[model samples]
Target: MAKARLMVVEDEAITAEDIRSSLEGMGYDVVAVAATGEEALRIAEKLKPDLVLMDIVLKGGHSGIATAGELRRRFSVPAVYLTAYADPATLAQAKLAEPLGFLTKPFNEADLRASVEMALYKAGAEAERQELIRKLQEALDKVKVLSGLIPICASCKQVRNDKGFWQSVENYITEHSEADFTHGICPACAKKLYPEYFDQLYGKGSGGTPE
Candidate 1:
């Protein structure tokens, strides 16, 4: 199997080198290393790495969270944050970006490997789920088209189906679709079908009065 491609974004030179070494040791292919958020975004778009290891605090105005958000929203790239700070406020902000994982700084090789593997697996599972839902919706749409349908009669409130069978409107609709029927009166239908009863309950000028 091919190695999972990764892009590392860290401004600290020593930290970046250490992360690159650790990721390579874990059998991931480090496609590119970027010290700034802008460079990270550019490399991510062009190279299309399988995952991004981003440091939350960066040199430029665009922080790791901002870059990760852009990558996810625009290119659909999965990202895991590698940060020194894990304060509640920072974590809350990070949650808004929807990172696959967050690893605090000074992490060992085991933490690095585990976080990366879990992030990739989560991303893969989500993609599979979306594809399955899409296929199910397509199948349902085909079923609707294959089933015979009928138009309702305006005067009698009945349906004339393709088989030349005339049925009650509700019965015809319920047969062909997933709709659950609940018997209730719409204001206009109530007024038209039971005019005397409507007038008795609510008086002449009420909006529910028959047309």
Candidate 2:
């Protein structure tokens, strides 16, 4: 499997460097380090990193939650929030972003590794689901295209097969295609083709037989 690309968002220089070093040691690719939410958004859009390590409190116009929400809306990127303060009020706000995981400050290498692994797993599952849905939509789109633009002879009412040969519409329809046909005669055709039978059946000009 390919290594997961990560973006670290932290305002503090020491903390950001530590996280980057630990991520690299864990076999992850640290694409970029951002000090502000605005900068993170810009880099994340360009890099399309697999996961974002977000700092809940950053020096920027947007908060971590707001940035994660925007990224999710724009690119469907998954975020993992980090904060030293795990107070309920702060966590309540962080939960709004629907982060994959949360890591408190002063975390060891093991904690970072576990959090990053879970985030990558969650992101991978979501990516697979979206890809599946896209493929299904593509299949449906192809079906719709085949359903339209069918070439047929309007006058003879014969369907033109893929080989450009015009065959009886009934036989053409009954080919390997999914459609099934039941043979029937309409009132107009019955009257024109078998007028005597029509008269006998409907009492139309029955008094005068075919002379």
Error of 2 at 9 (Å): 0.2
Which candidate number would show the highest lDDT if scored against the true structure? 1
Q: Estimate each model's TM-score.
A: 0.70, 0.67
* Model 1, TM vs. native: 0.70
- Candidate 2: regions farther than 4 A off: 137-211
Tens digits of per-residue lDDT, candidate 2, 60-119, equal: 699888998888878788899999889999999999988999999879999999998988
Worst ten in a row by lDDT for model 1: 142-151
TM-score top scorer: 1
Per-residue lDDT of model 1, residues 2-34, tens digit only: 999999999999999999999998889999999
**Each candidate's lDDT (Cα)?**
0.89, 0.86
